[model samples]
Target: MCGSGQLAVLLVLLLCALRDVAPLPDSGMLFPRESPSREVKELTGLWDFRADLSPSRDLGFQKAWYKSRLAETGPVIDMPVPASYNDITQDPMLRDFIGWVWYEREVVVPARWVADEGTRVVLRVGSAHYYSVVWVNGVKVTEHNGGHLPFEAEIGDLPQVHMMAADGRAAYEDVYTLPVGIRTVKVTSTQFLINNKPFYFHGVNKHEDSDIRGKGFDWPLIVKDFNLLKWLGANSFRTSHYPYAEEILQMCDRHGIVVIDECPGVGIKDIRSFRNASLAHHLVVMDELVRRDKNHPSVVMWSVANEPASEMPPAGLYFKTLITHTKTLDPTRPVTYVTCSNYARDKGAPYVDVLSVNSYFSWYHDPGHLELIPIQLNTQFENWYGKYQKPIIQSEYGADAVPGLHSDPPVMFTEEYQKLVLQGYHSVFDQKRKEYVIGELIWNFADFMTAQGVVRVVGNKKGIFSRQRQPKAGAFILKERYWRLANETGRLPPWTKYSCLL
Candidate 1:
């Protein structure tokens, strides 16, 4: 698995296992199809394309035609997308050319679509030759080395791009500009510093799951969640088990929210899953993930995996390779993996820059024993810190709360208990915030659908907000707590600090 946590939600990347399956389906293994919630704009008209006829076909690569107007690089003629350039040309050399052919076009996205913070605008190239490299506004977004595989790039709020006529305007064009918020993330011995100040990640773990679209992207749903995040005064969240859409990260970059971009490396529960082949594939996913999200300022940390079988004998070398490889890919940010494994036995713990621990205290360990929360939670922090001395984020906590379920004494699965569960964790966090504990993200930001299991209730009810984005009693509790923390911490917008000049 290559990436996981937004708001601390762990998106289980079951997609990684699909590579091992034979004859993958065209739907998931291929480019996205237009759904009711999604709209597809075709780029199949004539394009400015040219075939490099130099002695070395590497002329385009050397000159970097993708960076600027293809016409400026050389002569160009009309060539159609989704069709072979050889078929359109009358010249024999153009037809017979067995080298790199360059194609470029400027398609203006809809202003409404660009304005919508939730819409993730992806450009899908249906078919291309042997080796294909894609760039959005001159920045390389994706590289595919295989044939017949349709590739696409999710270019969120695409950078300003224009190749105009002599008059400085294309025949038709629309412009949308995005201002980036610049900030730095540092993980020291006892703190998670953003813009050189200790910041607490008092947020919720979130899932992309919803009632109608499921894991599919929906602009309305995404906007509602962003509204809830701001309403709750949460400054940061983990992508949970895997990386979320580029659109969400773009919102974070623009709005000054923090993120821990995780890979799809989940469910390595079996010892056999830690083999070299699996490790090789996992590295590729990280490569793709980093290329897509590396520039987003909101992404402060990179999570390599989530809850793998770290106690296994092979896990030591396996995680060492995985974590180190991710660090090498993007050294700008710290790297981590969510672990529910025992701290002493987890092979990957030593490699992570921060210890993101997932624990269910009173709910799972001693059902309804709220009093034990502080004791157990404190020990959890002390043990991990005593062993590693690294910063810690209570990446996952909180008990499932069935909305409106009542109990006088705060029983499990009730709203009261969920409120108390958070209260219990918060008490411990308040104690450790001054020490090595850097952040605390709840188990869920909202209740989400999951596979039917004994532990699930219709789905997971651990969300402070229901799956519909409506607040539970716990949401109000968190709103007050988070706002207080924000004020006490003097949380400023990320763009306010340009440098360390203070």
Candidate 2:
């Protein structure tokens, strides 16, 4: 295995090769097709709970009381997978525990699951809230930082097939697997690795809150969110500003979406939070995240900061060190930071495996100057390409929408505006595919609530879906474009049957 020093060397080599190297992979690499032969393990179920920081939380996830309490809980508390605490807790104290949560569930590996040596089971988290450490049947499988990014843990070593002991007791009492199955199995962090290659993350930023739910979400509702993005042709997703539920990540893994696991580090614009933020605290948060979701196969990158432009020098150094530390903890995937600096060349852009930039060009600038926006974007990409030689993913790019306002030929800001901007973006994207630019994810999948209050009708209606799960005209425009771009098949999948907006 490559050590930390080796990884650092690799990063340096990337920097050294920037100016002259051609692009790595073809931009035409389509969204990965589903694997019919693979069987996924579902870890969704009731989790035993306690919030007072009791010692029992540390007894590990296998304690009898914990299991019994979780199983016996009524209504199963309706804690949806791929959701957040914001959806569950109404208590003041519980509401702010955004960085920590203990999740427990019982899973039985079917007797036929490990029939083949190459088959494996994975426990994946779409996005962790802030920090998390995941344990499977008491085995520490994976952990991750970054609440918005996806992460997973490998449960291959865990028995895939289970049955009652010879005494016919608990269904999980005994486990069996082919001896060769162990060779392909592992217990590790879910750093992103697609087709055994490090895939650059490309997708939109997401928020957990909907104006309707006010932070509440159920499984069916959550699946709607996925369908909205999937049909729009997004292969990757970023849980902007906070950790999302594991339910989302599990779906992403099964559905073949790359995830950028993010931390709840946004909104640090205030000086007080910046000063109070400690590397140790951030490390603790990130450590938990890395521990819990590292085994997921869909998570491709770990993002530590977003829009830290205000703290340029110090924040830049902080991000570099954090990325370095992340590689130390788990080096399978890449590290990145989304910069709001608008400059084609960001201060810390060189440190990441992929360069991510957020630009409002045509949206905030001149919508009439649509042609010029892509040019400006390309110029910026060129500057970074000249310096980093790393794959570039337009992390954030989209205009705000009011829903139901699209024009046929497409106009800017109207439902047509999304289609217009996408048209411009794809125009440039196609041109640069040969230069190694990967792909683009529209800024958001759904309109969501933000504390910013800068919104007009509601807070940040950039999503293709309105805050109430209503499909906007932009959703349709985006869906057509996304499908054309990714070459996806038929209607929304099983998880997204209720909402076909994508």
Candidate 3:
């Protein structure tokens, strides 16, 4: 019924409305999974690598290195993919390199994937160093600036094929190669639940540390750690202070392990450090962490900071903003920050969904007085419950134990002392299990390297296992307690009494 110009104007208005209503592109990291129209190929293997040692150098993308033209620029060396370039070679320079290292590889997309219009091609890197930039066949695809989590690029169309030989000795040849997926993690007033069922975190706090790799993505070490966790009757773990390699999360997903993915916002003390610059970096880290690990079923919660200065008045606003932002990223999982602050008066306690506390009652507080653990823990838990009325997790609690030390009556650094310390915490944990206390993750799973200090022998000795991944005397004590707790907490079915031991 309208005139031509009026009709055209109406079309313009409709189009503008549609544009405003359209959903935004997903900014989250992608993990390849085989759907009806999707396929994946891992681009992990040998990659040409070099580290820039110049005091000043421009960005790699600004130099247009993603064009796969590094061979034309300077010298190149072969290095393994999914690895940190720091400790791969005998050269001390390469082992201690801290600057921008470049890695490049030739990849070929599958013809079948290119043929399907609905199919999407993505290149996924499990983990890299502090920063990484990727180019797919001379086209800049993605750049991620975090070392711990995975980053992916959606390569829409496969370019003309010109693949190099596998041994890195020849020219180009066309070959088909290409790439590459939550349970509901709910929290009630009294319990943590997965799919509406009560869940308990019988786990340890872990770091991606080892003898040689030094935070590098090592598959064998990952397998060993998971095996050790299973052997210890652990069903969960916190990525203690930073995001772990994606391969670790994938294995946890497949093995039915719960994860509390944490950020590297440790040692954030004082109001000056909690200002805009620090908070901005913290938010960026949170964005990357959520985007990368959002889809993993193993991840039940996101830990924003580890042992932050929560007693500071400014910390209240800092954590509140960060926690609120994390919730916006993924509203499904609970957001919490690990605090060593007193429950009766932590400035950050009101900001988190779960009250995560790191208590060292007997070890640090009363110093070898195991008798005070239960009483102290009980009072703290009661205070936290009364104040917050939220679920609580003993995010960290442990004692330092040297591997071979032994004392019958229990002395500090002795194996018997570690066992007794755990027994004391377990006694209190059992009593609080009936209430709102949902989890207790031991301070660490394995002994790890740390900055040298007067109090530290070699490193923090709180791990149930030694640095070599060998179990200490405390390991058996935890194994027994965890198995029993899992059974009593209904985490395992009646027929699965000793399944973790299997």
Candidate 4:
């Protein structure tokens, strides 16, 4: 062993995702050094506070104090946050009032943050007692009950969870019900069979992210995405990188859209994170995820992690235990983990029921070499299937295409380049899909917010759809390709002949 064994830099997603890849444009800075993708802002200081003192105790709501300055509505006392108002104030009425006590703090947001639409501003409340609601410029952003643990809200739009409860009792009996589709999913060495027929994973990887709302769920966005999916004839999707909202899975169940439910196991890069304690926590998350999602028939597989550092020695044991625990929880479904590691070195490859791999031949590996994709992609599939003898999924593949970007001869980050990348991958898939490859999920369903960087224009531009759900040129390409898939393979929707949704 070395005398001190100290390292200067951390290598994340190292060796695994980065084989034969181009070098970084710049060197790494030391720890705590700021980069384009990192940011921090604190909201702590003075606020104006006033308790509802009128007899009815609803003065703030009635007068709409959130509309304007709380000081203008009534007499306000200076207050400091990070301390409870009841404990800080001297007046007994202010201390004992069992009503709305409004606290307003005026903080200026830099114009640069607003001008750069890709920048995401989040408001984190350290602690708010009992209940709280927040507003800015008369637009409600968030509300919460219980405190101590930090809570955050995106500044653009209202959270949909704050919707008023509807009285369903008037329309129906107390026993709530939904239509359930009964189906079966089976996996063998080279195929995924749904209801006794071969099935292909022709779908997208989705995130519940959008412009303005961020991760805030909105009904309009939800319905529109579903419509878009239908129009593309997409039969399935992976709840990529992490689980989506429960309502999304329910919609999948209703509309015959299949799902590969994944947990929040993306970027398990730090080798130290594969310790026993971390593995135990990972198991607990799997338990909760399976318990929540086992009822949905649309869920064909359980993907425990995405693009983990499986080449690390500890990964074999970690993924083995994880996949075994998941199968014990729900033996009806096959379990797998997504890997971006090379087949020869990926330690976790042998244990999963299906071999799911992600690679960008022309994109991440050999940038600007579109001709490299067919040979490289075909070799990738061959090597994986030869070693594992398990059905393989091209879990993720796509190029970043900035919306409205065009190039006459195809160039990276342009719409035409993205189209060429897909065509290259498809050429390989057309050769292997019927033989051994069972699925192909595009890198993203839509563009999503990411930590900003030079390569990312505000966010990852890998989606076929823009962040606003508008169709990019690639969308039309997928639309045509998927429709052809539907025509050739009628069982793409598993429930194509049945009216399973009520």
Which predicted model would earn the best lDDT?
Answer: 3
What clash pairs does model 3 have? 32-180, 40-180, 41-179, 41-180
lDDT tens digits, residue span 196-273, model 1: 878788887777777744555567888878877877878888887767766688788777788888876778899888
lDDT of 4 by residue, 1-502 (tens): 1122221110000001111222111111111112445345544456677776778766677887777777788788876543445446557665445656677766644433433445455565543443566776666655543322234556633232121222322222223244567898888898999998999878898987776545544668899998888878799999877766666778888888989999878779899879876677577667657766778888999998999999999988888888889889899999999999879999888889899999998888999999999999989999999998999999999999999888898899999999999989988888899799998899888998776477889689999999998888888888888878887886555444444320
Question: Per-residue error at 294 for model 2, in Å?
Answer: 0.4
| lDDT of each candidate versus the true structure | 0.74, 0.56, 0.74, 0.73
The candidate maximizing TM-score is 3
**What would the per-residue lDDT of candidate 2 be over residues 1-502, giving only the tens digit for each residue?**
3332221000000001012122121111111123444444444445445432334433323443222334342223344443444436666555444222444444445544333344454555544444455555444555543334445555655532333223332223223321110001111122223554333334567776764345444666778777666666666788675556656666777776777888766665554444424555566556656765576666767777777653345655666767788888778767777777745435566567776677777877675567777788788778766766766767788888777675666666577776667667767776775466665767777787654454445467778777777877656766666556554323223335445453
RMSD of each: 15.7, 14.2, 11.5, 18.8
Query: Which scores greater on TM-score, model 1 or model 3?
Result: 3
**Least lDDT summed over 10 consecutive residues: which range in candidate 4?**
9-18
Spell out the clash pairs found in candidate 4.
Answer: none
TM-score per candidate? 0.68, 0.60, 0.77, 0.66
Residue 260 displacement in candidate 3 (angstroms): 2.1
Error of 3 at 109 (Å): 5.6
Q: Could you tell which candidate, 1 or 2, scores higher by lDDT?
A: 1
Give stretches of model 3 more than 4 Å off: 1-26, 34-39, 55-78, 90-97, 106-121, 135-141, 154-189, 195-197, 362-372, 407-410, 451-458, 493-501
**Candidate 3 lDDT, 1-502, residue by residue in tens:** 4332221000000000001121112366555565434456666678777666555544553665555456655777887665555567788777655556667655545544444444455666666655555656665566656556666666655464322223323323333422222467778778998888888888899987777666666778888998888777788999989988776888887778889999988888877868887787688878888888877878889999999888887888899899999999999889999999777658888989898989988788988899998899999899898998999999999999988889888888888988888889888888897889899999889998765687787788989999899999889998888878876766752324456545
